[model samples]
Target: MLNKTIAIIGAGNMGTSLIRGILNAQLTSAKKIYASGTRMEKLEKLKTEFGVHITTNNKDAAKRVDIVVLCVKAAVIRKVLEEMHDVLHKDQFIISIAAGVTTESMEKIVGKNIPIVRSMPNIASTVGLGSTAISFGKYVHEKQHDIAIKIFEAVGDVVVVGEQHLDAVTGLSGSGPAYIYMVIEALIDGGVKMGLPRDISTKLAIQTVLGSAKLVKESNVHPAILRDQVTTPGGTTINAIHELESHGLRSMLIDAVATATIRSRELSELINK
Candidate 1:
């Protein structure tokens, strides 16, 4: 168990998801978690549901925590930082889930050389299968880094990368769920085209994607090699693979990631400005 008090500054979807993930994983006790937000009713509901402390005052929530998680919107991160500035000490750690908000911008606002972590967690976090990548500021120590990793690992997998590479992470895993959803949708439609009912098609497509991913993860095998394993010289799977290759599927996915990365950079520029 992580023996620390954590305050989630926003009681929104991502914040709530992280809170649930933490509690479900038994990382920390509910009483040690403080949730703050603008809506009293929602906060009260959360308090009843999770038995966590809930408050409307951001500073109050922030002042008494080992780690403060910034789960607020990207547009208001600066404002929230300023609001919590006086309360945040160097000993306290910061982990922001706000997309495109760089640690530098956070450092500039906090002005304490505090350890701030910029994290990108996709919407899959809502389901406890999130893919989160964390980038640290200059002041983070080894212990603090481990704490950050442990906190995120409650929700799902966590990877560490240079702060500069976060945009690509944002483009890939951060926005990857939607891309995969599209693929699943297409697969379901294809199954329907082949005379399968919509519901059955949906389930089959979802399981196929999930099982394939599980196989790749468990076997530690390259996807191309795995693809070859399912394919024969003159088989239906090869015929399907030929269609996907002919349609420039790989190239399109590459372009999609690159475009998303560039857009992430542009959004960061706008936010940091």
Candidate 2:
């Protein structure tokens, strides 16, 4: 068990999900976790459901915790950092989950002395299956880095990357869930077009996607190899693959990730400015 107090500074969907994961994993006791937010109803709900301490004062939460997770939106991260600056100390670690908020930018607001970690966790985290990318600031120690990893691992898989590569991570895993959801929807629509009921199509599409991902992960085979294995000469699968290739499905997905990466970089620049 982690013997430290952690405070989540924004009790939104992501923050609440983390809290549930942390407690369920027994990384730390619920009493050691504090949640702060502006909405009284949300704060009280968290308190009642999780038995965590709740407060509206951000500084109070920051002052008492060994680790602070800033889950506020990117637009409000600077303001929250400024509010907690005086209470945040060198010994404490800060982790930010705000998309496009870099560790460098947070350091400027909180001062360079504080250790900071910036992470990108996709919406899948709500279901304890997130893919999170972590990047450490210059001041973070090895132990602090491990702590950040453990916290995120409770909710999903975690990867460590250089700060410079976090934008790419944001483009891929950070924004990947929506892309996958679209694919699932399209597959369901295709199933319906073939005369399947809507509900059955939805169920089949969801399970097929889930099982295919599991197969790729467990079999440790390249997805292309797996695709070839499924496709026989003049088979239905090959025909479907041909249609997808003709429609530029692969190219479109690649372009989508690239565009998202550029947008992430643009947001970072704007935040830093």
Candidate 3:
């Protein structure tokens, strides 16, 4: 829980999810959090549901908080920053979750002296199982960095990385959930093809992925070693593994991440331009 007030400048999905996560984690009282957005009905709904202060003016929200969270889209982040620039103080911390919007670009909009932390959090944040990667700007101090970590930690896991590596983080964790979803869908289809009912296959596939992930986290062993443990001479698991290998699954996944990283860099360049 942070003692300082937080202002979320956008009431979009990620912003709303953070509000819910912070409240659910008891990291901060609703009274200390303020949300701003364009839609009156949405702001009113958030105020009613979360018991937090809500406003349509971004500058007003920024002026009243100790930390400002930029949750707007990459296309609008510059506009929001310009709107709040006059109200933002050097002492206040800024955390941005807009994909491809770098801290350097935000510094240009706000000020060179303002502390900024840029982060990438996946859609799983809504489910409290997100993986977030954070990077600090030149003006950010140790305490402000810790606060940024606490804010995201309320929703899920947090990892610190260099700003230069954020594009790679964006490629891996930020886009990884969609890849996992595709795999899960394929697994469910495979089960169904083997005569299992659709609903049963869905449950089995989801649970298998979830349980396997949990195992990897808890075992603290190499995944390949774990896979070897499940494989036996002339066995079903080995045959399945062989099939995946024959299909070039490993190389495909590697290429997917690499391609996503390249695209992330291109998007960042576009935003910075």
For all candidates in order, the CA lDDT equals: 0.93, 0.93, 0.93
Tens digits of per-residue lDDT for model 1, 123-227: 988888899999899889999888889888888899999999999998999999999999999999999999999999999999999999989999999999999
Worst 10 residues of 1 by lDDT: 147-156
Q: Model 2: number of clashes?
A: 0
Model 3 worst lDDT run, 10 consecutive residues: 103-112
Name the lDDT value of residue 193 in candidate 3: 98
Best by lDDT: 1
Q: Per-residue CA lDDT of candidate 3, range 156-210, in tens?
A: 9999999999899988999999999999999999999999999999999999999
Evaluated against the true structure, the overall lDDT of model 2 is 0.93
Off by over 4 Å in 2: none
What digit string (tens of lDDT, one per residue) describes model 2 on residues 99-192?
8888888888988489999999988988899999999999999999899999999999999999888888888999999999999999999999
Q: TM-score for every candidate vs. truth?
A: 0.98, 0.98, 0.98
lDDT of 1 at 193: 100
